[model samples]
Target: MTLQQAPETVRVTAAVEERMVTPSLSVQGVVSGAPTREVRFEGSAGGAKQIVTSVAVAQDASIAFGDLLATVSGVPVFLLPEGVPLYRDLRHGDSGPDVSAFQSLLTRLGYLRGSATGTVDARTLTATGLWYKAYGQKLPESEGKPYVAVDHFAAATGEGTVRLGPTVGQRLEPGKPLFVLSAGQQAVTARFTVPEADAVKVGTAVTVRASGGASFAGTIASIGPFQSNEASKEQRAGHDVRVELSLQDAAAPKEASTVSVTVGGQGRRGPAVPLSAIRQGSQGTYVTRELEGENSSGTPPTRDVTVAVLAQEGGWASIETNPELPPGAKVIVG
Candidate 1:
């Protein structure tokens, strides 16, 4: 209808079915792991690869391995003891791919000047020896025997030679590493090193938030094995603790994003309301209540209402309308 050409009214009536109106808060936060873990591995050219350091378990406030050790380049990151570390059975086949993997690591670490194609070349082996010698690690000889840890990589010739230990400019052999290098060089942990001043008792409860607005309601299937406050939900940091939280259904996160964590905080129950819907009177605050609206079943109606002003924030107010109010009650806003 046009503003000036309004039609006469026809009265219509409907029923008001009582329904429950639940409200919640939408909090913005970053997710993180409350606990994490790591494992390390060792391998040589013609020897059985072993997990020398094994799985390093840190918990309760211990430092994680990722925060301490670095990974060897050109190797696949692996979770060992069950899953196979990358490049396992390399001794049985042509060494091309293996050489490529090694070269790939070398290229990443600024050691090799060629493409990461697995070919056992003279320069590659020499670079490999240089890497170990530089890092002060032990390496098997050309025949893959035991090992002599290299001390330094420079001779008195000033710039013409690269030493392989106490030996002056020992030449590197093909298909053999002068020093040991493996991708699974070390394992990492996901725990944070809590300060002694802030560290809680062993069984103290801690609250953790999830990344990208995850949830914490419903049945908690499990708690974390360790503790840390350093994990970021954005996955930006190189190392952080990870906590696994499972839910009964996928939809619980829709209700609320951040759960009010109660480590040792007092817990209580209170009525929640919108900040705008509330208003202050001489005695207290009040909210506006509508006498009519539509129901979830898709029928509109009206009923008696007493609006209680609970809270106010931003442009909105949390008001408590009549509990008997229908799902979609219309109210006059100020």
Candidate 2:
């Protein structure tokens, strides 16, 4: 009774404030086509009827540039680069960006000489003649060369899978779709409810987590407006939206493949502390700041400060608090 209680002692572990933070939202998504193209055999049978006498590659075969896709009436139909899918034939006086591209590619392939003037002039025909000769075919007497046929041997700008639509004995029709070629390029798509849609926007940076722990970086390319799906009862009851993402990385997730997507908001730079320092209270979330004793000599007292948690990631959070936290400020984490 005579002895007074020693000065109250408070012992606790804590973390210090370091820097700012950005928050993230994780969602489920599927790998889908940025756009799957149907590769059609646009070659004319030269006004003579021809049947698909024989088949070459099997269904779903992975084809590459210069690979022989099939044999059409004893003539080799090969997979070439993407540029050959021209809608109309390329001829002199037909000047456009497409012609320029064709000219450039022909020059690079050593099939043509002179600059790519963007106009299909005499040089284009010279290049065309050389290409036809190399491919064992003579230049057509027709005014325009079959640009689509040239695609048969032009370098494949995009690699794709073989989707054969025509079979042996099938009659070829002028301008009708033949076999389809899939480029196999893909993007990621995420679904969300009306409420969640408000938080997401195009141009938001995102990371897709693939199977086996692989992660790829991308950006939100589009956000679809809310629409009802009459096919599903649940979907019909709530507004649903789609978010399309464009991958910055080369490797694309397989078709119909599922992956995890982490969407992050525009990053902000500021002071941050360990997540443990944040506490949920009756009022809201808050953190305890340690105050220095007289002359900064002894154990310090602590005061609770209200804070608005903006974002939390990587074990830290970006917060809005009064009298912004100073570097090295001690905070009670536990």
Clashes per candidate (backbone, < 3 Å): 21, 10
User: In model 2, what is the error at residue 61, expressed in angstroms?
Assistant: 10
Weakest ten-residue segment in model 2 by summed lDDT: 234-243
Off by more than 4 A, model 1: 1-94, 143-334
TM-scores, all candidates, are: 0.30, 0.41
Tens-place lDDT digits, model 2, residues 107-143 = 7678787787877787678777676666565555454
Off-target runs (Cα >4 Å) in candidate 2 are 1-25, 38-49, 52-71, 76-110, 114-126, 136-176, 179-184, 191-258, 263-270, 273-311, 314-316, 319-334
lDDT of each: 0.33, 0.62
- The model with the greatest lDDT is 2
Cα deviation in Å at residue 294, candidate 1? Answer: 14
- Measured by TM-score, how close is model 2 to the native structure? 0.41
What alpha-carbon RMSD in Å does predicted model 2 have with respect to the real structure? 11.9
